[model samples]
Target: MASIRAEDLRIEFPLYHFARSMKKRLLGVASRRVKEDPQNRVVISALSDLNFTIESGERVALVGHNGAGKTTLLRTLAGIYEPVGGRLTVDGEIGCLIDPAAGMDGLSTGRDNIRLRGLYRGLDAAQIAALEADAGEFSGLGEFLDVPIHGYSAGMSIRLAFAVATAFQPQILLMDEWFSAGDADFMAKAQTRLEQLVKASEILVIATHDMDVVKRWCNRVIRLEAGRIVGDEVV
Candidate 1:
């Protein structure tokens, strides 16, 4: 079964621009002892002492004000950021929709990107062919898929990206607000696809400011403030 567990999980980022004196002053103003990594570089804690377990069939929403670590938490779960001072275990095939075009090569054709996505996921030739066919049909980009992605418009790019990212079913799905491009028909199709994906996944974690969406799709909410979880509730 796919699951996620965090034990006193802590994530931090280095403050490379801060002088020692400035760091000291900031630490004093914050009234907290400064933490340094093994290399002794000053760091700002992004998540602190987090403990949680997400089992199969959980639909969880990460919510908080801006800079409250919602996005940071999502990134951490996706393995984009390593915890600096704790343990995190995730067992699943993860599909990240954090940024639809995040890892795409803009200079490459959309077709090339489909093949690359297949390769990254370690799909066999038959599966890659299927993904290409699926993306081509779902994205509605037709001949544009053969052209370099940089030449596509914003809506076209998002459609292609979303199509390719979701070509395979993942055990765990992670997403940000993420649905802002395309026309009305595309929006409707995207919404349907999102619902289908969520239904098919073992676990779903999303970070969003949209309370309506949370209420509609999530069963639990984990709220954060200043990198600490303040509220964890079953909706």
Candidate 2:
């Protein structure tokens, strides 16, 4: 069964060189009146002592202000970032769309990217070929699929990436936010496709600031504050 459990999860990013020096200077002035820990390194804590469990069939929404660890948590769950401390277990095949162009090469053609992304997702040659036509049709890029992605606009890139990403069904789907770059007509189609994909997945976790989306699509809402989950509510 698909499931996710995180116990006291902690993730931090260490600052280096110029960034480290700047943080030190800023903290030094801010800490003169406050107690400063000598062992505290110049690091940004993204997740601290976070604990959560999500079972199969749950559509969970991560809701919080910017910098509240929503994206970090999603990335961590997607296996793009490892926990610095504590334990995390995920039991399912994960399809992550944290960044639409994550596995795509700007220098490569859209058709080539479909092949590359399919291979990266562990699809065999035959499977990739089977999905190529559908991906091309959904993208509406026509001859542009034959050209390099670098020549494509942001909306065009999103179309190709979305088409390729959703070509295969996943046991667990992770999305950072709703894709909103396309035109009105494309957006309507994309939203429909996205809803269908989400329904097909066994587990879905999305981080977004749109309350309407959370209300419409998610069954549970997890609110985070300063790297910790402050509230978890079932809707």
Candidate 3:
């Protein structure tokens, strides 16, 4: 079953220096000794007591302005960041592409990164080999897969990322923005395959500021502002 539940989730960044500075403010010790690291900066409140639940086969779009905590929430849900408070539960195979290049090693060749991502996503060697062959059709970086990924142009990296991400259908697929890349001609070809992923995936949660995408792709939508949910409704 594809399900997600988050209960009173609270995420916070620690303020070691901010706390210490409070004491300095009281004690009147004016010294620059605390400039050792940036961790002394004020702690940030990323997510504040958020609560939500989604049953099997539901689609939701996260809509928010830049830095309104959409990515932080998604990253928390993807288990990349541990919530400081609250409980979250997910039942499904989650495929996340929040950061297209998160797992890639720039020094590695595209071919190696493909295999690495496949393996990290839990596919065995035999299954990865089959998927690798199809990756070529979509990646379009012909002959460059063996070249270091650091040298790939932005378009080429996006192409390779899309290919690797859509190599398999997922139960719960998460995306930040549907990347727009490739030449106009290549994009047309890639669009068909990208759409194929949307059709085959069982559940999806996409984060975007694009209102048009939220309308077209999500049956339900939630809008966030300043780390709080300002609106939510079914489209």
How many clashes (backbone N, Cα, C below 3 Å) per candidate?
0, 0, 0
Residues 117-230, model 1: lDDT tens digits = 888878999999999999989999999999999999989998998898877789999989888778889999989998999999999999999998898999999999889999
Give the TM-score of each candidate: 0.92, 0.92, 0.85
RMSD after CA superposition, every candidate: 2.0, 2.7, 5.3
Candidate 3 lDDT tens digits, 1-235 = 7898999987775556446657446335443222222444544677777888877766789998887788888888788889878899988888887877779999999999998988887888898898788886678888999999999998889888888887878788888885776678778877787667776777788888888777767888988776777888888
Per residue, candidate 2 scores C-alpha lDDT tens digits across 99-193 of 87887898999999998988887788898898788899999999999999999998899999989888778889999885978888889999989
**Model 3 TM-score on a 0 to 1 scale:** 0.85
Error of 2 at 163 (Å): 0.5
Q: How high is the lDDT of residue 212 in model 2?
A: 90
> Which residue segments of model 1 deviate by more than 4 Å?
17-28, 31-40
